[model samples]
Target chain A: MYAAIDIGGTKIAAGLVDSGGELLARHEHPTPAEEPVTAVEALLGRLMADPRWERVRAVGIGSAGPIDAAKGTISPVNIPAWRDFPLVARVAEATDRPVTLAGDGVAMAAGEHWRGAARGRENALCMVVSTGVGGGLILGGRLRPGPSGNAGHIGHMCVELDGPPCPCGSRGCLEVVASGTAIAARVGSTSAIEVAEAARAGDAAALASFDLSAKALAAAIAGTAALVDIETAVIGGGVSKAGDLLFGPLREHLKEYARLSFTRDVTVQTAALGGDAGLIGAAALVGHAEV
Target chain B: MYAAIDIGGTKIAAGLVDSGGELLARHEHPTPAEEPVTAVEALLGRLMADPRWERVRAVGIGSAGPIDAAKGTISPVNIPAWRDFPLVARVAEATDRPVTLAGDGVAMAAGEHWRGAARGRENALCMVVSTGVGGGLILGGRLRPGPSGNAGHIGHMCVELDGPPCPCGSRGCLEVVASGTAIAARVGSTSAIEVAEAARAGDAAALASFDLSAKALAAAIAGTAALVDIETAVIGGGVSKAGDLLFGPLREHLKEYARLSFTRDVTVQTAALGGDAGLIGAAALVGHAEV
Candidate 1:
């Protein structure tokens, strides 16, 4: 088994995952998001206290970006307290085991490719559309983390040349139009859940917001299919929880942009691992070098 | 030595290539583009009539797409007489040598990656922006031709969500906005050459046309960098012949779009092998399976 750590904005989750990619045991703790580095480290210490800790052969961490996996550091957007934090060295010191690091997007892709929606597919893209949008690539049957560990940032890719200015300093990023945050803002809601609820209640404004987000996501997916030849896309996170409300139009809009013979054949499916995909993917990074 | 065939809209060019990617001897025949398939085959026979043919061990053909490299067929847009032409099997039969096939764009990219401006860059995009824009990818130190050999069709990848409807049935493709054909059409010229000369003479309309094209190209380049992590882009073809007139604005506009750290570092360079890149890349396709 490997000890896996999944760091996100809301919380820090850890688990022991077996070779078959099943979580053997798990623990979770609220992130001391604004506290010093030691608080998070202490949370990790608490996570490893599970009886299965001794069975872990390696430590794998999947953190939000912008992360420098090569430098074993992360400066996730929401985790202001961990600026370029030396998480890998700290984890290695505590576990006395080899540690692997990758962006949360990459970890989600690896997890889906290993045992979830992308299983058996050699080339795929896995994405999360929550508070922020993130993505990862599976190419030629392997997880492509890229040099800076940001290969599948489908959200940041600009589909609209002059559509809208993005916080990444670019204009018309997919994240600006398709992310859960974008959906919430467009629908005049504080959360994606509220938008989903409004849409379920058949509110016209809410429906339009979901459709617009779906269209942007579809365009990004089609563009990715054209560029990299992905055969499938596994989508997850808060926005995907909207289910068919987001997916039906996403499939329809994909046809509008995916005109080429190759791109037209791509398939879309919801991620199967739910919230624990990051944990499982982090574990795979420990020994599955390609992932 | 290998036999290399570069099939394009205007002509059929064949040459003998050495192991080091050097062209030993060559022959060019204006495409009997409107004639029957037999006329083109005759041109290939004449091309191989060079005494250097005896040294050729394999044959490679790079044709304008949409090509089915797997089925060994070409359906070049201008060469309508050769729809789904069995060029590979016919070449093998005539030369008694193994034959390989790739799209013209893939061939150009492979050629550049092997011996030109992209020689040392493991992750690069090589493009041709003449009558139409086309591109190919070099990923992880080798050419990635994708499933149907159209992985790097950067020209077709949408950059502007609602810019314009392209003939390829998509909207705002890089090709429609940035190709030499587009430049010529925008400047009310029959050819890109006239547009270039007009721009060199400080014609305001011609200069703006080039700038628009450059911006489109830059956006496509930046988007590709964001999606695929390309380190460099080597551009060729007639529009590229305008030199700084095209590249100057391309670099400038790239800065406006490539705001992400990984994409900002990407460099753009002119193609070194000029027109011969396709022939050499076709030859590489024979033995380098990745290409």
Candidate 2:
């Protein structure tokens, strides 16, 4: 058995996972947002006291970025309380087992590649298009976290060279143009779910907004295919749940952008694992090298 | 000893290279633009007759793409006579040695990574910005030709989603806005060299052309960094000879586009091997797995 922890801006999740990737017992807590590392230590304490902890051989952590896997620390954007927090060391000490850390993006990709949409694929890209766009690469059938464990940052890639300014200090980044925030901003809505509801009710503004987001996503996906020759792209997260509304236009625009022979055959699939991807992927880190 | 062949649109180069990467004997032939495979056969016959060929253990061929490295065939866009021509089999038959094939872009990057500007860098992008932009990647201290031997075709990646139509069927591709052909078109010149001369002579049109090209190159490089976390980019080819006319603007624009912590430190350098990169890279293929 493996112990997994998923640290996010909104919540902290803990689970014990079997070798087959099944989460046997799960626990969750709303993130304090301003709490220090003690909060995480307390959560680990609860998990270690569980009887399943006796069977756990290793611990895997999936944290929000920007994480320093080399330094075993994280400085997530939304969590203001933790700047370069030593999560890996603290967790290892609490659990009394080997610890591995990966960015949430890398963890999601690892999960998808291991047992979900990208299964059996040698080269794939798994993306999460929720509040923000994030992704990771599966190259040669292994996770490629790169030097800083930030290899597959597809969200920040510039698709429009002289387009609108992004919060990341660049112009025309994919996240700025395609994330749920961007989709909401396009139609004067408070959230993308509202936009999706409007689009389903035949609202023109909402429909056009989804179209534009799909176009931007197609460009980024096709660009990734050209750069790395990925044969499959597995898209998950809040936006992906919209189903054909997003996938229909994404497939249409992909035909226009992915014109090269090698890039032309790329397949886009809905992520099969849904919300459990983070915990499953975090546990997967125990079997792979630290990202 | 290695027998290296670099097959380009205008010329075919053959050389005997030692293990140290030195070109011991060199020969060149003007490509018979309309001729069939016999021309390459005749050239190979001359190369085989040389006494130095007796010591050659393997032969490497780098050809203008689109090449099917897996199938050992080539169908160069410029050389219409060879449509999926079986170059590898023919070369192996003539030389009686094991042979390998790679795209010209992959060869140049391999050459640069092996001994030129990108040498010692584990993750780098080596680019040639001549008539068209072409490139290859070095990841984890080795060349990553991807699944199709075209992993680092940076030129074809879209940077400006709505900019301009590219010959490759995509809009706002780096090649359309940044290649020597693009520079020449921007300046109403016959070639990029003429634009370089005009820029050196204080011509506004020529200078603006180079600046725009540099901006596009910067966006692509920064985008590449975001996607793959490449640390170094080595620029070569005809327009790269413009020196600071191109590099100055590229560095400045890179600062603006490469804003993420992981991407910000990317360094740009001039390719050290110049024109000989193709042959040397082709020869280096004897040591790597098929792209």
lDDT of each: 0.83, 0.87
> Lowest-scoring 10 consecutive residues by lDDT in candidate 2 chain A?
A33-42
Residue clash pairs of candidate 1? none
Which regions in candidate 2 have their CA more than 4 angstroms from the true location?
none
Model 1 chain B lDDT-worst window of ten: B33-42
Q: iRMS values in order, in angstroms?
A: 1.3, 0.9
Query: A140-194, model 1: which lDDT tens digit per residue?
Result: 8888887777778887877787778888888888999988889989877999899
Q: What is the TM-score of each predicted model, taking all chains together?
A: 0.94, 0.97
Q: Positional deviation of B42 in candidate 1, in angstroms?
A: 2.5
Q: lDDT at B183 for candidate 2?
A: 95
Q: What digit string (tens of lDDT, one per residue) describes model 2 on residues A83-181?
A: 988888888887789888888988888888877898899999999999999889998778888887777889888899887899779999999889999
Candidate 1, after superposition: displacement of residue B71 in Å?
A: 2.5
